[model samples]
Target: MSLAAAPFTSLPTPLPAPERTKTRLLELIKRHGPQTAQDLAYKLEVSVPAARRHLCDLQDGGLIESRTERPGGRGRPQHVFALTDQGEASFPKTYSGLCVDVLRHVQQLFGQGAVMQVFDARSAEIAARLQAEVPLSAPLPVRVQAFVRVLCEMGFDAVLEQDGDTWLVSKRNCPNLTVARQFQELCVSELTMYQTLLGVPMTRETRIACGQSTCLYRIGP
Candidate 1:
């Protein structure tokens, strides 16, 4: 996907420009594989010195590794850079994989109808799993707190907002939405199931702003 078409959380932010640059460099490596400094400079449109500075920074961050390359009759070796496991983590590939993993698991459970039942089932499963990790004897709000924490750990920017007698469980960002549009319904159903499992009476409203571009799940009790 074009950078502009990426999910909201994947969008480049104004803050942390240096870290973002390093991430962009790693993305380039992941996309094009290994490359020398000159290649990176030309692709990124930066001076050789500036590219080297960013490369060094990324190396320091443990996101990339460099190895010496020698041509058949080269007078000197050049350093070629590529992504390391740690570096690859900075990109959305891992999150995309997680999305696929979850969907696969859901498909196994619900068969061809997984698209319909998987979301709610997964949410219920997550709630059950999380209950084991935290003290469950607490009040409803405390339990919801535990649920939100688990959601955040699972890479959802989940938040619970109070609105009078009801609570709104909202996710501002989901990393998998861009590449997994077929599974968008899963997110909605899962969020709905989360509300049900939380023992809160809730109403769900789903809004698709564009064709697989933006999805909003608003759940309120």
Candidate 2:
């Protein structure tokens, strides 16, 4: 008998539907990991069978895995699914995770408390640094530019416009504004600190009518 050659196996390829489903599923998994099929279906806004079909595709693609979970008094155990290493790689990169990574590095450099203290010190240091750059006799517009630049450094998209000797500093974007609204006291404090540093007698008022999507700080002389 002649010996037959072994058949070559092809690598798994992700289909378009499976790819789209996997992308969304990975996002959900990153937000809430180790979910059951029913939970994933609800979160993804798809039917249970549809969710299962996508999940099966992802499993075959090596992007996710499932494990059995048994609750008390259950006839059969449920399978909880989560992203594989390959799955996490499919999602967008997050800077918050990088921030934590930096914190870990700082902890290594100094200590855990030192990292905390550094965070505390940063606001004051930032204020002082900006103060040093402001010219005492500069025009109001120039001073406003300096202030907005400092705010931008702190990850706020701030812009300044002058109208009749008054400066309006609008916060166009703030990545943390949604979660930090509860800490509005901190936001006001930082704004006050910058105003003091600039030696500008600008009255500060905030508008929260637009919800967290938009917040405004009206600074006027």
Candidate 3:
């Protein structure tokens, strides 16, 4: 699984040249694992001093940490820099790819019925959790807000909007996009889950899996 670089959280919106270099340094550590300043300097094509300065800054910002290690327990110790949890979050993950592969294997081995069972099981689990966390007994607006919050917590980037009496919940990004693209049954399972959680019939206005900008659900007044 290849790691794609994302904008650094520790840096400002408009990253300066030095900060951009720091971002690259984080990417290097993320892609290649722990590395010494000398190794990073060579990879980055910068002087040792410059690399050390960037490493120092990143360390201070709590993105990377260093520990001393000696090669094969011989010779002097060298400091090795590695990404912290915050640093690891600065890159795009390939979890969806792994999930797609697993689902594909399941379908190939046990057939489509088995795949449907997987989706149904996952949907039931999500429904149970939402039933527990969200106040389904509350008013529609309250339930909608809570549902959107839960979706955001699940990495959906969900938002709730109102157009007169109707309400729309939009998911800006689908975390399971890779899997949904291959097996759209996952989408039907999601829509069913939303209706079950909201206790109201909802219509999908647009679908990300269908190449729309967002997965939009409209709740009638």
Candidate 4:
């Protein structure tokens, strides 16, 4: 199996050395499944002792576990590291199952209109907070920058760009993706919120809930 470590750009910058190594270790195990300490050390280019130390820490933190495996069912035993449930959750996800369950209950109790109202209220609340943080009277580009900043703060992997005369805002990660899949009213509420906040017409080109890689919105003329 290829032991090449994949590039991860989403890790927060300026991570401390030991923490960075541990995080990478988790990523490697997550991507490659169970890996021997020797393999992890080789992949990380760290000494076996160092790798073992990190593994111990992860095990203590309940992120990874080790199991003894014998090569060819007869060779000497070696330990392999695998991610625990906690470790798997360290990665990003599009939606929350708990949130989905709560929404299901809400729908069952109050009907679809109430669900729509929930999203509408949520959109308004988020829009109000963003408006307070990013002045609506500011220039469109400035507001766009603030919008992206606010989205990032709220756990959305959002970016802003200028496409000729138009501005494009793309969200690469959705914090409530699964919820949106079940409640498309969430997407509609989002568009309405953006227009209300920007005070300009906007169009959604693609939706993550609709199977697109990104939720793309086109703003400006």
| Order of models, best TM-score first | 3, 4, 1, 2
Displacement of the residue 36 alpha carbon in candidate 1, Å: 16
Instruction: Please identify model 2 stretches exceeding 4 Å from their true place.
Output: 1-122, 207-213
* Model 4, residue pairs in steric clash: none
Task: State the number of backbone clashes in model 2.
Answer: 0
Off by over 4 Å in 1: 1-86, 91-112, 117-125, 133-135, 207-221
Against the reference, the lDDT scores of all candidates come to: 0.69, 0.70, 0.90, 0.89
Q: Cα deviation in Å at residue 200, candidate 2?
A: 1.5
Ranking by lDDT: 3, 4, 2, 1
Give the TM-scores of the predictions, in the order they appear: 0.48, 0.42, 0.67, 0.58
Which portions of model 4 show Cα errors greater than 4 Å? Answer: 1-95
Model 3: how large is the Cα RMSD against the reference?
9.8
> In terms of TM-score, how similar is model 1 to the real structure?
0.48
Local accuracy of candidate 2 as per-residue lDDT tens digits, 110-212: 8756664655576677666677666657876677787678778766777777677576777767665442443344455565676666766655465443364
Better candidate by TM-score, 2 or 4: 4
Quote the lDDT for 77 in model 4.
Answer: 88
Please write out the lDDT profile of model 4 over residues 1-221, one tens digit for every residue.
Answer: 88989887795578889999999999899888889999999999999999999999999999999898786678898878888888888898644787888888999999989888998999999888778777888998888888889888878889989999999999999988778888898899989998998888999999999999999999998
Q: Locate the minimum summed-lDDT window of 10 residues in model 3.
A: 7-16
1 versus 4: better lDDT goes to: 4
